[model samples]
Target: MADDPFQSRFAADASLLPHMADLANDRVLVALLAEADYRAASFLDQRLLTDRVGREWMAWDALPDLGAAAAGPHFIFHIGHVGSTLVSRLLAEVGDVLPLREPMLLRTLAQVAERIERPESVWSPELYRTRLAQTLGWLGRGFAPGQRAMVKASSVITAVADDLTGSDGRALFLHVPLPRYLETILAGEASMAETLAQAPARMARLAALLPDFPHALWQLPPVTRVAMSWLCEMATAQRRLPPDDPRRLWVDFEAMLADPAAALMAQATHFGLPIDPARIEAALAGPIMRQYSKAPEHGYTPDLRRELQAQAAADHAPAIAEAIAWVEALAARYTNLADLPILGDQSVIQEVRCSS
Candidate 1:
């Protein structure tokens, strides 16, 4: 192989080979990656969000398949905004648990297993099964016997919980849907439409290969619109399953972020995890606080806000009214800034939230 001579740094430094070999061997890299992942700065953490997924369950189906029981004590966490990242990062600090962001272990096994058939498209189910077990074994290689670790996964996997649970493993579900998190990223003088527009190009290529889906939807702009569609799709699917299934949990992000100390305590108590106070505080104050504080104070003129509210009301009167009522109810649940005192009217923000 070396005789073929593809000149590169790969040949220059044999040390680099050790890192790759260790990663292939599933030794140093996994733990190192796990630590580096949790320690990453706020928006850049990419723990659960290594892609442009906006940090939620909708991103799960997009991941490579790992057959059954790849992850146990499954944290089918559905989250909204950047705050969910903070929560996840904090959870990793617990000594008993090795908080996996999105582990490549399972998928790596799946890929290798699939190689047996050497097919161009899909692998046989048996190969997938083989790979899945191999991956799970490797995941626990670093853990002390009888020690348990949890996988915090994207909620999109809610559709496949039965495939994931095993007699040896348990599951815990958590939700952290920020009521107005989309606003943080979408509404800053930066139009959601603009963010969505970039998505079509990416979706175009994806649709060609994933013909099971409608290509027409690919025309929808990328970031905001495409992201929103995935959320609705995944969230609706998750809601359909019974809560008793041990397959899911739902959290209102605004509620948790409003008082994380209390919320964190409740979650740890409920989920039966160690409460690592120092880590929790570090995560919250580190990334989430910085991101929200630095978020743009996008100035939308009163005239513009008024025009938008009026237009939204006219376009969908019943839905708009229903949304307003929902907001009122939500405001009561999350008291502080539910209806920002600075706003001219509640209806204005309602238009953005409901976008009816």
Candidate 2:
């Protein structure tokens, strides 16, 4: 490595590497270079995105130890279409916190586990465990004193929760209530299109979860297919998350949106991150709430979303109604899932209580 000013400066900062951000077709690890800090980045995308700066190809043999430099790198595990992104963005607003949203490395590991193939000669579960821990250690390095590192994983990555969190690690399993989740999928053309396009992949994931998932599930109504996918994800969350683990917390999207300050503060407390209540309030009132968390240029407000949902419901009345009915019928069919909110039980409204 040459000693150029930019390279020299960034090299010393152990917080730079995001493990397996670029796993090439040939199994080499390519590093996607960005500024050391992602404070100005967007959370709308699955991965932590930044202005393209440069790239570096790294050999595992040459990889340095980062774990010692890292502080506590907490995780925000969530179900898709929820407000996980919003929570991540708010946390990053604290200036000292580095929030990595959906690192591709974790996703690759999850896929590898499902397929049961070692893509590289040197790759193994133990290798991934060591490399990921070291990378996380580096990520845990706070930009300043007492800063925290947080990772917001994609919902599907719940398959590898054990590897990610390890024993005695902490995580927050986040999801939207069943009705809101269905409406979220049905209300947006993009959402509906994505659901259709990813149907095959979702089915493959469900097959892993439900041993007897019928082959005819694909032939069922599209609405039912989406419902099944949601169920599979929920089941994953429930399975991986230890109900009695004090370190593990469960949250619903509706609760967070209803009370941003309290919810954010509670999450901060849960993760052991130090935050000023005044600063959190300021951030909530500022751009984080006013702008689209994903694409800040587009303004976002509660009223705007409600209006859009109403318009969508009116435009796609039949489809929305069918989707709702399909979910209701499924809920009733599975009496064993009575405790699950999606199963149409009103008592399940606040199963995972947050600190009010």
Scored by Cα lDDT, where does model 2 land?
Answer: 0.64
Score every model by TM-score: 0.48, 0.80
Candidate 1: deviation at residue 125, Å?
A: 0.9
- What lDDT is reached at residue 258 by model 2? 65
lDDT of candidate 2 over 205-251, digit per residue (tens): 75665555445565767766666667767767766775457888888
How much is 298 displaced in model 2, in angstroms?
0.7
lDDT of each: 0.40, 0.64
lDDT of 1 by residue, 1-356 (tens): 24433213222211111111122333422122333442342322224334432222212122233345334443434432234444555565443555544444343432343354666624466745653553443343223343444555443333334444444344544432222333333433354454354345334433432335443653433333434433332333344333445433444444454456766766665556667777567655554443332132333322343355355445445543343343344345444324322122345345434532
Q: How many steric clashes between backbone atoms does each model show?
A: 7, 6
State the TM-score for model 2.
0.80
lDDT of 2 at 295: 70
